[model samples]
Target chain A: MTAEPDLDRALVQHLADLARLHLPAERLATVLQNARRIVAAFGALGDLPLESGGDPDLQPVRLRTDTAEPPLPLDQVLANAPRTAGGMFVVPRVVDG
Target chain B: MTELWQLSAAGLADQVRRGSVSARDVVRASLDRIERVDPALHAFVDHRGERALADADAIDGARARGEPLGPLAGVPIGWKDNLVVAGERTSAGSRMLADYRSPFTATALQRLQAAGAVLLGRTNMDEFGMGSSTETSAHGPTRNPWHRDCVPGGSSGGSAAAVAAGLCPLAVGSDTGGSVRQPAALCGVFGLKPTYGRVSRYGLIAYASSLDCVGVLGRSVDDLALWLAATAGVDPADPTSVAAAPTTGAAAPAADLRGVRIGVPWQLNGPGLDDEVLATVQTALATLRELGAELVECSLPSVAHAVPTYYLLAMAEAASNLARYDGVRYGARRGEGTSCDAMTTASRSRGFGDEVQLRILLGTFALSVGYQDRYYGQAIRARELLRSDFARAFAACDLLVSPTSPVPAFPLGSRIDDPLAMYLCDALTVPASLAGLPALSQPCGYTAAGLPIGLQWTAPAFGEDRLLQVAGAFAAATDHHSRRPPA
Candidate 1:
């Protein structure tokens, strides 16, 4: 009741697709409702005068020299993958034959 | 209470180093304490007492062989689940990486272990550091040690609760918008979020790349100082880490804090603030004055807009940072042997909790082609305004002070279903996060119902030394930080 939110079924589907998440039909309504409410609440930031500038407090990222270093062992690299073969991660095939 | 577990981190380290106490016995005592108290608290998601005991024995053996002892030799500490320890499970309190063992330890954690800090276990947190109350943790929420019915303010709630309950003398947590300080306030302990770039972030499962910082929770300010000495420094592994030395403030806390200017932001006195919390912070300010601090009321008008701005930026960053967990290279997967897109969607949908998913969707929507200008772009401008407001406020005063949380810990589940209510809980603390300032929260006093209240002290970037000096002096002047919750 505090603020009107712009959440609709079509919008939820679009956002979910973009985010690469699947919201079940049953849970979609509640998720949409919550997202709408949070977006509206956070929309308060929009009220501030819009002037563009960089955050001066942000520190310059110090990049180290791009030196070749020993990489992690293959066994350790594939230790936690759900599926791996031929010393590589095996994902579902993407391209048609 | 166990005798060995009752000692501070420094005290235990000294005893162990001097051969007055064996590190094995200290670890055993802490393990016993955790077993006794953690059932009700549920603070730790991973209990590795056996591994901790073995690690402590290694320190004891090193000392036996006449090896030089590190500053934190044999002191046990807990890690928030987000920070990785090589060969250990790290989930960030999400189901996504529940079974994923780390490929390498975080540089901060590696540094601490090298300094002889023994790993106790990994603590719980809000899933991906999203929620204010830790209720969104896929692992159950951590309860406040003060009142079991109430929540520990989070996503660093578990670390704060563990330190408060004496399960460990020091626990490392992550702060993204009050995650560390808020919980420390609720749990009646010291929680310090050092300046951004103060600590390395090599393997800290990223919540918000620009905003996330490793923080420490402990019973004493000295413990935080000790932790920073061990972990804070430039790390080649983390490109954003600063080359700043751990600040060495005054030799000891001065008897009084003369010539210090603490600014009180006028914007914090608005509605939705609890009167009792305000009164507690006011009383703490009076104590600071008695110690010779001069209070100056200042203005940070843009701070009123900090919560929204902080969340917006954090969400956008999280969306980008978390895009890596699409059931490809690592982490648990679902919808096996399906199309790449379908498998990724299925895994993410179930792996992430509701709050996390909501943030992703909202962030994606904000960053979408048509809406990016209105939401994502505006938040960046608001952040600049907030930071400039801080710049102006700090120009007028040496430090900024406020209630770490607007209210004391509330009954669990009270605001779980209310997203705005949860977000508003962090209203007072997010401004510092947005500005990337160093801040600390310590127990100022307790409410009528005996719930703890936290008073916060914030400094401009790299002001950790002075901030800690004043906070440590105030802590020495008062007994608020020493009060313990009833067992």
Candidate 2:
């Protein structure tokens, strides 16, 4: 598979935004260079046929049954909070509520 | 009284049992060692000297009253920072969790404590166990005991360095891809990566859940064996933990492997392996033959793909596991922002290191919908082939042997620029991890430059007893494991 010479820098920025990372302007060149390397490295995997109607490549995790359990006491939970007010974790208002 | 700090766990335990040395004396000696060497090695992230002494006093008091004692009663052991201990900061070598204390202790740590081992301190590690060298630690790098300028192989570098520097007789480390064995090799000590699920992973900060295994590092194989006996078993809290039978055997009996087949994999003897390392490994093989083990040549054709496969699986898991660090519950918090996205972005941007950020991004791409089949899927297939190769090779041999690392500890910051070069250091070691097999690295010889080289012995899955037996026998015959670099 041919490498995508022109990568979507906007997409890269979008991911950084989603992951909550701040990329210094000067490091953008290095990030893009490294990103290309990674893309090329991962692109090699495209040669393999993964749709072979068999067991998935990843092993199945032995997940436990989900059930409702007693929650920690409000006081104990609050005690761990870095900032709390009025029995609730206080943070900068992100939502109208 | 015997110098408790200098004795192996088995020796110390025996002395305590026979009333030759009190558990309090042992703990005191260990604390003294920490005070002396730790300043130079920076091995311990946090020392619990007061609690350690208190526990030691209790153990001695119990013994005086003729109470039953655990096998490791009064022995001091260091737990890697990634392993949670109640009320202790488990920074995991990251600033994000620099002050994060666990509400509960790790099952393995709890079991060790119950077995009467005094916790010395939490050893430093790669931030979330990411780097091959401990330089990535939010706390400064752990220097190799042998040479101050050199790095002890990392992730578990601190534990290995601490044991080699005589700061702790035994320490626990986690190995996803050679974290335990690599550091032990560079530090000229003994490290054992138990079979997957052999030890509970409930409390270990997940780097790669499926590949991560709690391992032990020590100055002697006997110490490793004793520690393993104390920590290994099924934990109901850890879903992946297996109910395997515990190993039962006497320590360091003069056993011969006259008819045992030892396979030397051709793939592991690859190019670029330092000549001195190869020579040391060759000499070790000859010694094994002299001790009655049959040596044979074997091949793991797919072994070449181990590094790529391991990187994919490990990073993929790391991405998922590290998602919890998003400034939500505990860890470094970003300033309050107008939106939740802004808050998380600011927090992670400030919290994670460059290498960690790079991995997260790479993993995110690999596991993304458009790339999952290409990268993660192919790597998984490669893992299966590597596992089958080991199974096939073990059919003809009781164990496989190779040089643990291509070279002894490289100068610090030597390969930091090239991630690929750094990843190649684990080439020989990752195949075993991928196959979920037990492998041990014991000091075999030193390089011409006077650096330590390690000989790795890997066995089939659930064959830890055999692996330990062989390593113990080899260690008993050589003084390499006992030698320490001049401080």
lDDT scores of the candidates, listed in order: 0.87, 0.82
Q: Candidate 1, which segments miss by more than 4 Å at Cα?
A: A1-6, A52-69, B249-251
> On a 0 to 100 scale, what is the lDDT of residue B48 in model 2?
89
After superposition, the stretches of candidate 2 with alpha carbons farther than 4 Å from their true spots are A1-8, A38-54, A57-60, A67-79, B249-254
Considering only chain B, report the TM-score of model 1: 0.98
> Chain B TM-score, candidate 2?
0.98
- Estimate candidate 1's alpha-carbon lDDT, on a 0 to 1 scale: 0.87
Categorize the docking of model 2: acceptable
By TM-score, the best candidate is: 1
> Per-residue CA lDDT of candidate 1, range B143-217, in tens?
999999999989999999999989999999999899999999999999999899989989999988888999999
